[model samples]
Target: MAYTPELSNDQSRTLRRIAWALNMPMTKAMNAVFEYAGNIIDKKRVCAACKDNSKCNTCAFNQKRWSGSPHDHQKNKELCLLSLIKK
Candidate 1:
């Protein structure tokens, strides 16, 4: 897989710290941290804490529902099947 270049050393270090706090392996932590950062940056969403909000649309830690969407359900089911197959 091609590596995604990090925007800056500070960004990279912050992501690593987040990963460590979550107790994830380095690779998985890196991937998850970058993915969440990408969503926030690309979506132009405000930070949840800065907004003094419990949850925001782009917060990675949010656990809101993906309900009432057939496509979402289908995609989730497909991922589940793929994981099972891999196992």
Candidate 2:
């Protein structure tokens, strides 16, 4: 049996497109693209010092890449209280 990757619709499409662009099979593209890991940092306390305190309270927060290196995690710059503490 051939294995199909479990990816979201968007993810599948993107990966397939990438594979086609690279002239590689979808599975090979998936392997080449996903040979790494990432980290998420909690900046919940950082919200305390945010000027956007009002928006932060209701924000359905999700993680974005804070650093170029996916393994390293840092505070959310715009909303993290740690920035205030660091100054």
Candidate 3:
């Protein structure tokens, strides 16, 4: 998805609110939220490797390529959150 810069302020505020409400560090909260969201999205999107019977290396959304490698779908979710924040 494309990033949207228009909502950066709003996203920042929302993140702050979430951090405060959960009584967690902002970065940790953000990471957890993004990871959870990413897993949900991954469940819906077809796994790239599964489609081709090839290794994850060739898949565009390969989980291993992310920060949380092997379980990196959260990284993708973080990217999505960043994009939304940019909006």
Candidate 4:
């Protein structure tokens, strides 16, 4: 068995450009993208008023991250990013 990475045409081109700009491999470029996006999502979605930082197990926002279907998570992530762009 073998595994292969796949991307849409636009995604592939964008990733290649990122890789070129960073002088890094595609995998690293993709990982960088994921980290950047996750930071945006976390900063936006995590509770801002909570003083307890170690209570993720009981936090509603953290709990929701584990409960959704993958499609739902992806849609929510896209919506979150889009909302940031629209602001």
Candidate 5:
């Protein structure tokens, strides 16, 4: 049997409108939203220093990615320095 998600009336309407605006099928639109949220959740799981491959070597925190963010991790520190600079 196929699985059906139980979204509220408002949530269903909003998703339908977003799919129409993007000119994509509802399934694709939902996948895009899910993927975006998953990435953000993964990013928030670590600080910028811990997330960087190069910096991870000399990072003062010396924390592993799987260990999660440090206790003193500030909101601003969550933003990656490389991402802020336009390439």
Candidate 6:
């Protein structure tokens, strides 16, 4: 039942399921998924506007993080999901 030490409960569950389905060990499966995900997400900047703090006041991600509610931004959920990948 041991998964990657860095994995959270949800991550561990996903890795365990993948490992079981693939008949691989938990670490190996988690490594595989992590590698694939890193390759996909590493190139993505998530929030290009985040580099400009001026936009933070209007940024949906910031707004949601601050107030715990969706803001009136077009890409709020998309941006938030991208920013939440590893976290």
Error of 4 at 87 (Å): 16
Model 4 lDDT at residue 66? 45
Ranking by lDDT: 4, 3, 5, 6, 2, 1
Q: Flag the better candidate by lDDT, 1 or 5.
A: 5
Per-prediction count of colliding residue pairs? 0, 1, 6, 0, 0, 0
Residue 65 C-alpha lDDT in model 1: 33
| Global lDDT of each candidate | 0.46, 0.47, 0.55, 0.58, 0.52, 0.49
Which pairs of residues have clashing backbones in candidate 2? 46-81
Q: Per-residue lDDT for 1-87 in model 3, tens only?
A: 267445388887988887776667778767666554644457326563256545566444455555354354544433333333433
Model 6 vs. true fold: TM: 0.39
Per-residue lDDT for 1-87 in model 1, tens only? 367564588876866675566666556666654444433342333334355454455444333532243224335321221221233
Best by TM-score: 4
Pairs clashing within candidate 6: none
Q: Residues 1-87, candidate 5, lDDT per residue (tens digit)?
A: 278878899998988876776567777767555533433454434555254566564433344532554333334332322232258
Error of 2 at 78 (Å): 40
> What TM-score does model 4 achieve against the real structure?
0.44
Which ten contiguous residues of candidate 6 have the minimum total lDDT?
72-81
Worst 10 residues of 3 by lDDT: 78-87
TM-scores for all candidates: the values are 0.33, 0.35, 0.43, 0.44, 0.42, 0.39
Q: Worst 10-residue stretch by lDDT in candidate 2?
A: 76-85
lDDT winner between candidates 3 and 4: 4
lDDT of 4 at 42: 56
Q: Please provide, for model 4 over 8-77, each residue's C-alpha lDDT reduced to its tens digit, 9 standing for 90 to 100.
A: 9999999898777666787877765664454445533457756777866644446455465423554433
